[model samples]
Target chain A: MIGRLNHVAIAVLDMEEALKVYRDTLGGIVSDKVAQPDHGVSTVFVELPNTKIELLEPLGENSPINKFLERNTQGGIHHICYEVDDIIAARDQLVANGARILGDGEPKIGAHGKPVLFLHPKDFLGTLTELEQA
Target chain B: MIGRLNHVAIAVLDMEEALKVYRDTLGGIVSDKVAQPDHGVSTVFVELPNTKIELLEPLGENSPINKFLERNTQGGIHHICYEVDDIIAARDQLVANGARILGDGEPKIGAHGKPVLFLHPKDFLGTLTELEQA
Candidate 1:
């Protein structure tokens, strides 16, 4: 079951401009941009009192967010992540409920070094969802 | 300054289908649908430990999300709301920092009964942002 609302990832064309809005303009506690080449994105965390907003930038030529950026030229909200207690059990339950999981239905070590699985957007009301083990 | 992430609003075409994904599939604590005709949408809250996800369904022909749903077809993330201590001060600061406020540049009573203002998506890295009075 989903426990906490993890982070909302926004794919941006420019990380510096995104930082200006979230960090300087909104006055949020923002983390420095960290490149996750393995994940194919550069990430910046805007920490709030209750949750964090993740600003993601395409890293390389085949970056995962490149397609998203192409579709949404101005950038956009990419996915919402929810924390689950037991990822395997959660995946099983979701599968049993006719939910589609992305990437062979296997949990991968996510950016935070936690087991994470992505759910199909069509199955989730067109919202790309990521379930991270809490 | 932003205090907390008030909620992330997802606009869905079908409330029933959206409920099936968030309530049954994800096992989130879902609230009963509350129709806010005044706001032109029906809302359902998926309460997480730290924050909430608001599912919004169009209520009337002139619903604000109607255009968004038309473009997205299925559904999508509508906006992200952040709580602020003083909305006027926040708006003034944001305006001074070259952020454009939507509509008449005045705070309107949001669905949560708090004074809220929407920022131009173009000015916020394409993310529709709402600032609510905390």
Candidate 2:
């Protein structure tokens, strides 16, 4: 089952501009930018007291975030992440209940260095959802 | 400053269909439906372990959600709500920092009976953000 809300991900055209809002304006502590080459995105974490905001920028032409950016030129919320106590059990239950897991249905090491899986938007009221191991 | 992530709001075309995704598929405990004529939307909350998910359906033809649904027939994530310890202070700081506050720059009672105010999407990387008094 889902645990704490992990982090909300947002696609951004430019990370620096996005940081101006979350970091300078909102006073959130911004983490060092990390390049997630495997995922084809550059990520920055804006830490807050209870959770974090993840800013993602497409790193390559084939990046999934590129397609999302094409659809949303101004950038927008990409997905929400929730922590799961047991990801395998959660994935099995979700799959059994007819939820489509993205990318070979296997958990990948995410930005947090924890196993994560993405759920298809069609299966979750049009919202791309990410499940991360707690 | 933001306290905790209060909820993630999703705009749905049909409440019943959306419920099947969040409640039945994901095993979320859903709350009763409530209509907010003033906001022109019908809302239901699915309580999760860390936070809540709000499903919003357009109540009237001129509802703001109707406009969002017109572009995205399949529905999608709308906005994110963050809890703030002092909403007035948060609003003042944000306004002074050039963040545009939606409406008349005032907090209104939200679904949870907490004071809430929305921020412009343009200022926050196209993510419509709501700040709720914690």
Q: Please tell me which predicted candidate would have the highest DockQ against the true structure.
A: 1
Report the Cα lDDT for residue A49, model 1.
88
Model 1 vs. true fold: TM? 0.98
**After superposing candidate 2, which stretches have Cα over 4 Å from the reference?**
none
**Tens-place lDDT digits, model 2, residues A1-134:** 67777988999999889888887887778899889989899999877667888999989878889888988988999999988889999999999998899999999999889999999998887889999999
- Cα deviation at B56, candidate 2, in Å, is 1.1
DockQ of each: 0.88, 0.69
lDDT of 2 by residue, B50-93 (tens): 68888999998789888788888889999999888899999999
Provide candidate 1's TM-score on chain A.
0.98
Which lDDT tens digits does candidate 1 get at residues A1-134? Answer: 89988999999998988887788888889998999999999999998889889999999899999988999999999999999999999999999988899989999999999999999999888899999999
The Cα error of candidate 2 at residue A31, in Å, is 1.5
